[model samples]
Target: MKILVTDPEGYVGSLVVACFTQQGHEVISVSQANAGAALSLIQLAVTDLQNFDAVIHTGEICGTQALHPQIAGNLHYRDAMHLANLAKAAGVSRFIYLSSCSVYGAGEEEYVTEESPVRPQTPSATCKAAIESDLLTIASAEFSPTILRPAIAFGASPRIRFDVVLNNMAGLAWTANKINIPGKGLSWCPVVHVLDICQIINCILQAPRPLVHQQIFNVGDTNHNYQLIEIAAMVAEVFQVENFSFGHHGFGDRGLFMTFDKIHQFFPDFQCGWNPRQGAEQLLNFFTLTDSIQSHFTLTRSPYHRSENHLFHTVSIA
Candidate 1:
């Protein structure tokens, strides 16, 4: 199938691009340097949208640094809605949007389902929830829009991210010879491997229109959920960081415990191949092979940081 994947150079986007290409799908990538100009450019790019069967949109400004609601809301929420319309205008049948489970927020609830109420507290998550709501409105018999709210994703990517929970812990463990939990380590955190996320997307792409149309699937296994301390223990085992401790006051115990039964029931063949231990091992191997082990796992060139820097440099040059 012919596919259009946005932000192909991003952490998640790069993985989706590689996975789709390896699966023999014809994938076209799109990136508008100016987030503010995305809507206009996408609307004008009629020739670029020709003959694509589906679109997987992974483009958006997101990070710890993207804390401002106004800026993030405009870039992710507004731009996303516009992109959805662009997909429909381009005659694309299937639109797959990558939403985050972070929209569920840091609730005391024991479990979060796709049906759970979203009380997004952060600007990033608020934007994600808003985008999901708007995207559902655009779904139709002809335009089958599917939203996958993936858990905190980990695993090596062409454009790897150490900002996520597990990866961050792994980085600290490898570098600092210790893993520290800022708060009590009981806060629940769910995780999914990057490859598993690709598999979920592939399923959505292949599934019948009736099955996935307007569907929201929390994309991870129930078993994959782990407490922050549990995660620290796993990282400690991998990096052999004996100095693992908890009970710092600054960080509170805000957790996300999501259930994946919806996606599991829909695609029975789907399975998360990488557990925390296995994923940690893969990361360790990656660090060793890339000579990052000696470099103290310091990434001199982070993809997200570089993208922002490049945009600034380009704008300055212009």
Candidate 2:
């Protein structure tokens, strides 16, 4: 199988490219550098798109920084729509969109399923929900669009992100010997390992067309939901840090507890191999092996901050 992956240098995108290439699939990738101009070229290069069997779009303004409406609209919604159109134009049948469980957004439900109403709170989540809706609307007999709403992704990647909750706590525990829980640490969040997300993409690509076509799947283990305080404790245990504290202020009420039953029932072969404990352990090992110091842990370089033309190569891993 041949695949075209966007934002191959991104946290999940990098892993997705490596996973597919390792599985003997031919993978062609495009970075998010100069998205507008690059996508304009891509439009002209429609013939090139025909060479791929599927498109895995992970190229978007991710993380909390995507709260900016203009940035989110252009990078997340516009770019995605353009890519989908190009893919469809090139006769690409399978378009797997990397949406977010954040689209469920601070719901009152105990467990939001794929069917649950999307109440996007942030601009980032709103763009995601909008993209999902538009992509579904464009679905056809020839074009099958599958949406994977992954939970807050953790675990290490070649393009590691420390902005996320679990990873941030792990870094703090390792460097400062303390994990700080903001606002009483009461908000709930679902997390999945970076590797698990890659695996889920592979499973979807391999599954029968009927099973995934126009389907929305929340990607995370049902058991992996944890309160912010619980996550802090888990990180503390893994890093062997004794000091962890909570803030006196109130954290935002936004929390999402997602059910993975739809994905599990649809693709029985899919399994979540890493939980918070294992993920923390992996991060600890990664930090130790890399000799990561306080500086490395403290510097938060989000993709949104990168130069528009900044490009990265696919990380080759064994």
Candidate 3:
């Protein structure tokens, strides 16, 4: 398999590149600069420059995504739209669009299926949903465009983001000695480990024609959904923070739990190796090690202090 990936420097993109290479697939990781091996010289977006065995557009635009729509979310809308067009024109064999579970909207409702009426309330999620319809049109007899909507994705990345639930818990527990909760602490958050995300990407790529062609599968494990407090408690236990405290920020909020029955049914052997504990623990360890070094005398005098703060603090979007 010759895989061409855009945004190859990103967390998930890098992982996908690694997955393809480790599996003995010839991989060409393209950024905005260099196109792939066979791409010759064309340009608009990275995808526009390459034709390969497959194209997985995992490029991202990040900011806080919530109920209300935002202008920043439109960034992804424009970027992904161009990306999809470029991939299609490049004559890629398979195209996979990395979407978020938030397309299902946020709530505590259990087992939201693929057909369960997409309710994209937030700006970012809304953009994804809008472009997805276009992607589905490309899923006809000629091309197979697979859409994978994953819940909160966690793992090690060149860009480690702690704003996500599990990683945030680990950050605060290690730094502030607390895991903040705003409401009943029972709102469900569906989570998927970064590795499982990689495994499923391979599964989708290698799958037989009729099975995955032009399909949308919600990727997750049986433990996909978890109550907020339960996840926090587990993270605390993982880090041995037996007495971590909680503070509420918002109220009367609910979240939707996702259904993975469809993907599970298709890839029966797909196993999620990392749970909330593993993810939290991994985050905690990273934070601890980094913090330990930063707290030292010589290191404290360096430029890394503010860099560390940038990692933990949510900068107000200007």
For residues 1-318, write the lDDT of model 3, one tens digit per residue.
887776665657778887788889988765532432333212455444455778787745453344334655565566666666666676766888888787877553556877777877656777888778778875656567888988777756655666667776666566656555535676777788777888899998888867888889887875668877888788878776665444454423466677788898899888888888888878766766676776774534445332333444441100
| C-alpha RMSD between model 3 and the true structure | 4.5
Q: Which pairs, if any, clash in model 3?
A: 107-255, 107-256, 108-255
| Runs of candidate 3 exceeding 4 Å displacement | 32-42, 45-51, 64-72, 242-253, 288-298, 301-318
Worst 10 residues of 1 by lDDT: 309-318
Q: lDDT, candidate 1, residue 88?
A: 83
Instruction: Give the CA lDDT, 0 to 100, for residue 152 in model 1.
Output: 86
Candidate 2 ranges beyond 4 A from true positions: 34-44, 63-68, 248-254, 292-318
| Candidate 1 positional error at 3, Å | 0.7
Give the Å error, residue 89, model 2.
Answer: 1.2
| TM-score of structure candidate 1 | 0.86
Error of 3 at 196 (Å): 0.8
- lDDT-better candidate, 1 vs 2: 2
Question: How many clashing pairs per prediction, in order?
Answer: 0, 1, 3
- Candidate 1 deviant stretches above 4 angstroms: 32-44, 64-68, 245-251, 292-318
